[model samples]
Every structure is written in structure tokens, then in C-alpha cells.
Target: MKSWTLTAKLYVSGLTFLVLALTSIGTTLWVTWNLEGGAAAVNEAGRMRMQTYRLALAASTSGPSGETLALIRSFDASVALLRSGDPSRPLFVPWSEDSRQRFRQIAETWRQLRAQWTADRPTAQDAARDAGRFVALIDGFVAAIEAQMSRSTTLLQGVQLAMMGLAIAGVVAMLYAGYLFVLNPLARLKRGLTSVQRGDLSTRVEVDTLDEFGQLSAGFNEMAQTLQSLYGSLEDKVREKTARLEVKRQRLADLYEASAFLAKAPSLDALARGFAVQVRRIAKADAAAVRWSDEGNQRYLLLAADGLPAALLQSEACLDTGMCLCGQRRAEASIRTIPIVPDPAVSMGNCQRAGFRTLISVPVKLHDRVLGEVDLFFREPVALDDEDRDLLDTLATHLASAMESLRAAALERETAVAQERALLAQELHDSIAQSLAFLKIQVQLLRDAMRREDAAAMNGIIGELEAGVRESYADVRELLVHFRTRTNEEDIEPALRTTLSKFEHQTGMKVRLEIEGHGVPLAPDVQVQVLHIIQEALSNVRKHAGAREVVLRVSRTPHWRFEVRDDGLGFDAAVGHADETHVGLRIMQERAQRIAAVVRVDSSPGRGCAVTLDLPAAAALEPAAPALGALA
Candidate 1:
């Protein structure tokens, strides 16, 4: 077990010893004082009884043969009875056996005299003298006992007061000694420890004694000095390492950001601009420029530059062809300096612009094919390091990769678009075209009946033509809507609103919608599935139920719930299940199941239908507007 702290041990030891000493002394004094008090009380009671007996005898001597004699006899008998009372009761005593015998003899003599006086009237001169002597003797004995008890009480009180004074003095001395030895030292130690804990390594406790506490303070001070030295050395090492790492990390981040931009650039001009920005940040250059290689190193074309005037960037002839061109002709791993002289033809004869001097162009090559050259210019001549040339080479390599990937992605998107167009073409030919052909045939038959001049045949043909036209239009419109929708990129809410609004507008029914909760965008595939499910539901309601008023509620809780209620004639959904009249209802159920959504249809023969669809919130999304293809 860990040893207790010195302060705790000292406190416990001092308090325990002090308590024991005080308790023992206090108990002894209390017991002695109370015992003495009990003895004194008994002595005083006995002395009072003896004094009363003496007074009774004296009264008896004064009255020889009267009622006073009888009174004296009664008093003497009462005292005798008290002396011979229960053994459990205390009796007064002298330390001598002779004094006890004398008290008993006096009691006997008083009893004989009381008996004679009570029997008859008597006069006795000698008896009165003897009784007076007995009374005086008893008075003296009572007085002596009282005096002894008073003295004993005074001595006991004096001893108790002295013991109390000693106890108080001892407690005060202990407290004073503890304050000087324990508490003051402890307070100093605590303040010193707090200062050290707060990082003040120079703070040290004053050594007042050759003890363990002084040793502890010295050890703490030594530990603080060690920590401060170690911290200084570690910080210096970390700063040196961090500075080196930061430069390399910045270079890498700049390369990646430039590569990302080049990959997405629409044209070569965008790529050149992005490369200029990245190189300026990486090189920490005052001015930078990119010069693309012409065919067969015939000429160098200035593509982009940073910290240069817009006029110089736009004008190709502004750069010195001699200096800018030499970078392409230089050795692959060589760095060359060229002097830039402002061309009078392109510089526009501005006196302020011609003052810049010294150009260093680094040639950019990818797999031995020279792509371009990056040129830097400074006001004063500066030497270029191998690391600087290496960075330029790395940036050129990344640009090449970005350009190649961009070409590949463009080709892939084109191929995918071609395949999707072909599929849509076939669907339209199979569904919509055939429906239109059949409607045309029905129209021709109606026209033929009109030429025959038969009224009943004409009327029947006209009725068939009208029915075919209506059916063909409904089928073609539905097919066209389905074909135009791009399921992979469709949104949910717009599709729902479009479908519900179409129903209300076409059927002239009062339809209201209430939407709630935070609507979030979802993946395109999930948006399509939910939109189709909503369309199917409302289509069934419009076809079967003659609903005048319909309410569409789209809300999101932990999950999305789409509820469509209609106040119209309804049929048993169970009966509709057995019968296949409502194929739309079956389609709705299948679509909801495919999306892992719940569908509830409540209806009776006379009541309305309430169709509720709940889908996962993660799968619910807002609808997208129809694209140009959809409009077509």
C-alpha cells in the first residue's frame, strides 16, 4: 500500500493522543468530584438529623410532664427508625468503631427517658442535666462532621479547577506548537508547489530544516530544470523538421490542384492559364509565363503568364523570339538564361514597360515530346537550383496526364449517349407509332362509310372512329410521357406535382396539396422510382373513382410519406384485387414493392379511397424538370 502523507500521519497522531489524554483526565476528575459530592450530601443529611434529635432532648428537659415530653419522645423514635432503616439506604459514619458505639448508646438512653415521660408527668433535675450533656455532645459531633464535609468539598473543587486549567493550557500549547511547526511549513510548501506546477521552474521552497520536506522541495526544483531544458531542445528540433516538411507539402498540393483544373479544362487555353497560376504559387516567383512549343521548334508561342500586363500576354510578338526560342533548342536537362528586350512592334512604344531584364525559361517535355516552356523573369539576376528545375519537370508531367484523361472521358460520354438514343428510338417505334397507325385506319373506315350514303353504317363507323381515336391518343400520350422521362436523372417532387396537376386540370377536380418537413435532394435513381409510384397511384384514383375533391399530402418525417385521398365513389380494394379491371392498381403495388416502400389503399363500396405510400427518407428526392429531349 502507498504510505500515508506525512501531514496526514502527523495530524492523526497528534489528535488521537490529545483526545486520549483529555478524555482520561476529564473522566477521572468527573468521577472523583461526583463521588465526593454524594458523600458530602449524605454527611449533611445525617448531621441535620442528629441536630434535630439534640433539640428534641433539650425540649424534653425543659417540660417535665407535659405534651412537649411526648413530642421529644416521638422525635427520638423517628431518628432511631431512620438509623435502623433499610440496608440499601446510606447511613452517616465516622472512621472509628468507638464513635459508632457512642451514637447507639445515646440513642438507647434517649428512648428510655422518652418512655418514662410519655407514661406520666415527671420532674427530673438530674435527668435534665444529663440530657443537656447528651444534647451538647451530639451537637459537637454533628458540627465536626459538617466541618469535615465542607473542607472535603473545598479541596475537591480546588483539584477539579486545577485539572481543567491544566487541560486548557496543554491544548493551547499544542495549538501554538502545531502552528509554528506544521501549519506554517505546510503553507509554504503548498505555495511553492503551486508555483512550480504553473511552470515557474525557478520557484523553490526555502530550506528551514534538514528534513524530508526540504529534500522533496530540492528534488522538485531539479525535475523542473530538467523539463525546461528538454522542452527547449525538442522545440528547436521540431521547428527545423516542420519547416522542411511544409515546403514539400505545399509543392505537392499545388501540383494536385493544377492537375485537377487541367483535367476539367474545356480547351488548351484554359489549361495554359491554370498552369501559369500553379507555377507562380509553387516557384514563389515574382513573374511567370508559359510558352508553348511550335511545330518542329520553329517558333515559341507565349500562351499564358501571371503578374504580367494583359497587353503583353495578348500580343505574341511582345516576347523576344531570340531568348524565348532558345529554351526549346537547349539540352533537355540544361537551364539557360536569355535577355528579354521589349519588341517595339508589340510593346506600343511605352517608355515605362521596357525597363525589365533577365529571363530564365525552363523547357517542358513529356516522354521526349517537347510540349512547352515555362519562363521566369526577375528584376535582378538570380541563380536557379536543380530543385527548381525538377519542380517544373514534375508539373509538366502531371499536365500531360490530365489532358489525356480529359480526351478519354469525352469519348466515353459520347458513346453512352449514342446507345441511349437508339433505345429510345426503338421504344417510340414499337408503342406510339403502331397506336397512331391503327387510329389512321379507323379514320379511313369512317370516311368510306360516309361515301356509301348509308346513315346507320355512317353513324356506326363514326362512333368506332371516335373510340379508336380516343384510345390511341391516351395510349400514345402515356407512352410518350414514359419515353421522354430520363429515369436515371429524374427528380421526385416536380414529377409528383406535374402528375397531380395534370389529373386536376384534365378532370376539372379540386385537388389540393400539403407538403411538410425538410426536403433534401436524393440520388437520381431513387427519385425516378418514387415519381413512378406516385403517378400510378393518382392514375388509378382518376380512372376508377368519380372523386370531386382530392387531397395530396407529401411529408417527410424520419421517412417520407405520400398520402393521396379522394372523396369519390369507391369499391372494395379486396374485390379489385380478385378482379383485374384496375391494372394500374397492380402496377402501383409492384412499383412500391420494387422500391421497398409501403402502400396502403383504404376504400369501401360507398366510401372514398385514401392511398398512402411511405418510402425511406434517404430515397425521397425533389423532381427534375424535363430536359430538351423530354420536350421533343
Candidate 2:
């Protein structure tokens, strides 16, 4: 009647059926007890009647014999058994008024018959009549019991039929109720679940009653609604993610293209123009401009411009810090965006007059240092989004890196030119210049001796002048050979040997080259400088030291060391003489300084010269430009 959970409903149904089954079992037990009692009574009555008849026959045939007395006693005992109600023998059926009266009459009749037989020996006719009467009474008693048993059997059969009908009806009702209340609802829930598994979020279960099944159905419907809402929003989230991935892919492709273009742009101006074009295309801007900082003159120079008016490009070619929109932002070293407004400031007037409504200025930086700024212009009054700003920032960074690389290359070229000039000056001062000066002094003395009209003096001076001219000619040829020398091998030893052999052949001097720590690495620039220093020292030996032999030793143990010692006339290196010899020493010192090396010239007027150069081990191994001689 009341709403119940599935478990409670099932329990109640089972309890009701159990009660009915117990009732039927109890009824069956009662009927069986009554039938058993009636059967026992009928058996006892029959036995007693047989004993009475036997005793009467014996009394008639042999008046009061021993067997007859025994039969009488047995009959009396059986009668007492029927009459006495023993507590041990329980009765299943209570004795009704009719049954009790019939039992009492049978007991009384048996006692009367026994008393008659015991009192005297009657005639045969009398005994036979008494026996017959006793048999009749027992027979009537048994008939009464049989009738009672028949009634109990009939009642038991009816009770069995009734209980069976009730049990069958209860079982059928229980099964029907289970199907309606539990099975049917479960089937509906299963169907809904199957639908949901097939991606049908709209499926829902019907709530028939306020029971567990109803609650479960309600929860399932709620879940379906939630799933429907989530499924709908999932599409939007997926779309958002797809769009983001596409943007990132496009950005990566743009960055790859820009990097390739920047690497091969050739010049800073070309790089700037190419970068501006890439920025305009990637950022969807109407125009773009690149401006570089000229810190020496304190001006921002317009390096390149795209999609801008000629007038504006000319006006903005060069501007001082804070002179215009780009310059003002560059001075601050920050990125800025100019929003479109009716009363826009005149600082961006040039861009506005060029049909640009919005501007974004991004500072191009190498680390924290700003090299320049790139300006992007839009035709409409469009606000820049974060993606656009990010793109511009990336472009600016690439531009700055490219600019730094170009500047480094230009510096390298200038440094090489300066080194060549120094080498040329050193060569002239050490070789041709000194030789020519010596020859000029000889000619002057020869002219003086001839004017005195002294033949011996004139002849001696002429011979000295002839020797000086030959020596000068030899020096010029050596200089020419040195200028054309090339050290194509990575190792400097072969180049050194070649130079020394040429010197020996030309001067007719014995030269020796010895190397220790042959595998020690020397920077190309350091090696070139050391070799040139050794050559210059040898040249000085041939010209002034007048040494017969020269030894060139190169070792690399604790540090790189080069020594050029010659057995020739040595000069006082400490003397402050404005001479060509000191000029060559100064040139060697400058060459050592370029690679952070140390040069020591040890010599005296009478002793041979030992020139040594030492370089530190930790210097960068940058390759120097080939010597001027190689260039020639």
C-alpha cells in the first residue's frame, strides 16, 4: 500500500507467503494427529473384544478353568487401557461429547461382562449370550472410531486443497508483482543505458513511483542532461584548440622564411628592406619601416621603408632622438602603439599623412641593447592583437641579430686593411729604404774623392760604392720574393723553411731551422706574425750583423716561443738611434701586440742578435689575413 524500496517490497511479499505456508503446515499436522488417535482407539477396542469372546467360550466348555481365568484377566487389562487416560500418550484431537459417551459405554459394558463371568459358573447358554453381547458392544465402538477417522480424513483433504490453492495463488501474485515493480523498471533503465552507450544523450527513463527505481531513473535523466550540455560545449572547445594550432603553425612557417632571408641578405640595407617586407606580409599591415641607431652622430637613420609615401620616406630619412614617433620610442628603448584618435599628436603626423591610421613600434634588440626599431602601419583604425604584437617582436629580434652580424663582418674587413698597411710600412723601412739610403751616402763620398783629384782615394770610394749598389740590388730582389710568398699549409714550419732557403740562396749564408714540440697548435695570425718577425731579424743579420750562419728555433712546451739567433754583427738594441734597424723592431712589436704576444730583442754591437717572441696559450685562435707579400 505504501511506497517502499525494492528490497522492502520483496521482504514483505516473502513474509506473507511464509505465513501462509506455515498455516497450511500447521493444519496438516493437526489432521494427521487426529487420524492417528482415532486409529489407535479402534485397534484397542477390537483386541479387547477378541479376548472377551475367548474367555466366555472357555467358561462355557470347562466351567472356570485356568485358561478361562487368564483370558478374563487379559480382557480386563485391555478394557482398563481403553478407559484410563495416560499422560504419556498425547491425543492429537480433543474428545468430542459423542466420542466420549461412546467410549464410556464400551468401558462399562466390558466391566459388566467380566463381573458376571467372575461371580459364578453360568450355564453354556448364558455364557454364549454374554459373549455375543460383549462382541456387539466392541464392534459398535470400533464403528464409531472409523466414522470419526473418515470425517478427519475428509477435513484434511479439504484443508490440503485449500492450502495448495492459497500457496499457488500467493506465488503467482508475488511473481507478477516482482515483474511489475522491479523487473519492468530495470528493463527500462537498461534500455536507456544502451541508448546512452550509442551516443544518444537525449534518452531518459520514466519515473513511475517514488521508489528506488524512481530515484535511479531521475538520476539517469539528470546525467543525460549533463552529458548533453557537455557534448554541446565540447565542439566549441575543439574549434578553439584547432584555431590556436593553426596560428602556431603559420607563425613557425613565417619565422623559418624570415630566418632564411635574413641569412643571405648581403648588406644591412638589403636586410632591412627584406625584413620590412616580411613584417608587413606576416602582420597584415599596410606599410613597414626599419630605422637604425647611429650612436656616433646621435641620430636614427631610416634604413628601409615599404608601402610608404615618398614624401614621408624622405622626411624621415634621418632624425635625432625624440624628433618623431619612431625616434621618441627608440630613445626610450621601448615598444609603443599609436591608437587612432581625432586629435592625434603631431609626432606621428608624417605617418598619418601617408594614409596610415594606426602604428606599432617594436624595438629591435640584441639582448638588452636596442640597435634599432621597426614600425608597422595599418590602413584602418585597427587595434593590434597580442598575436600581431608577438609577430612584430620576433621580426624585430631577427633584424637586430642580422645587423649585429653585419657589423661584425665590416669590423673584421677594416681590421684586415689596417694590418696590411702596417706590414707594408715595415717592409719598406726594413729593406729598400735602408739600402737606398746607404747607396746615396756612398755616391756622395765618391763624388768628394773625385773632386780632390786623389786617384787612390777615388778608386777606393768607387769600389765601396760598387759594393753598396750590388747589395742594394740584392735587397730589392729579396723584398720582391718575400712580398710574393704564400703559406698555404695549416702548419707554419714549411712556410718558414721555404723563406729561409730563399734567403740562403740569395745571400750565400748558411741558415738552420730547428723545431721542438712540433705538434703544438698556434693560431694562424700568431704564426704569421712570428714568421715575419723571424724573416725581418734574418734580413737585419745579412745587412748589418754580417753573420755567417743563422738558427731559427720554435718550441711549444710551457708556452709558444720563437727565437731567431744569428752569428753576425749585432747592434746595441738599447741605444736610442733614429735608424732603419729600430723601425723594423717597432714593426715586429706592433705585430706581437695584435695577437697579445711578447717580443724581446737582445743584442750588443759586437755580439750576434737573438730575437725571441712568446705568445700566451689561452688566446683565441682567429686566423689572420695573409701577409701583404701573399696579396702581391
TM-score top scorer: 2
lDDT of 1 by residue, 1-632 (tens): 01444566567657866786676567666545544543544454455455544544544455454556555755655555435533233333322354355556557766675666555544455445655666665555555445555655676677667667767876887787577556776788789778878977667777665445656756766777777777769888899899879977977788778777776788667877778877877777667887766546556777777877665556553334344333456244245665555665433232126344666667666666666677666556566677766777778777656555555666656665664476456445544466577668867876777788778987887777677677567656665555454444333567667767776776799988888876665556555556665665665665568889999897866677888888889888776463322555565676566556788888888798888888765465532332212212
lDDT of 2 by residue, 294-334 (tens): 64426788899889888988898988877766765433776
Candidate 1 TM-score versus the reference: 0.36
Which stretches of candidate 2 lie above 4 Å from their native place? Answer: 1-91, 94-246, 296-299, 330-333, 419-632
TM-score to native of every candidate shown: 0.36, 0.62
- Total clashing pairs for each candidate: 5, 3
Clashing residue pairs for model 1: 491-623, 491-624, 492-622, 492-623, 493-623
Q: Cα deviation of 91 in candidate 2 (Å)?
A: 5.1
Which pairs clash (backbone N, Cα, C closer than 3 Å) in model 2? 483-629, 545-569, 547-568
lDDT of each: 0.63, 0.78
Cand. 2 TM to true fold:
0.62
Clashes of 1: 5
lDDT of 1 at 272: 78
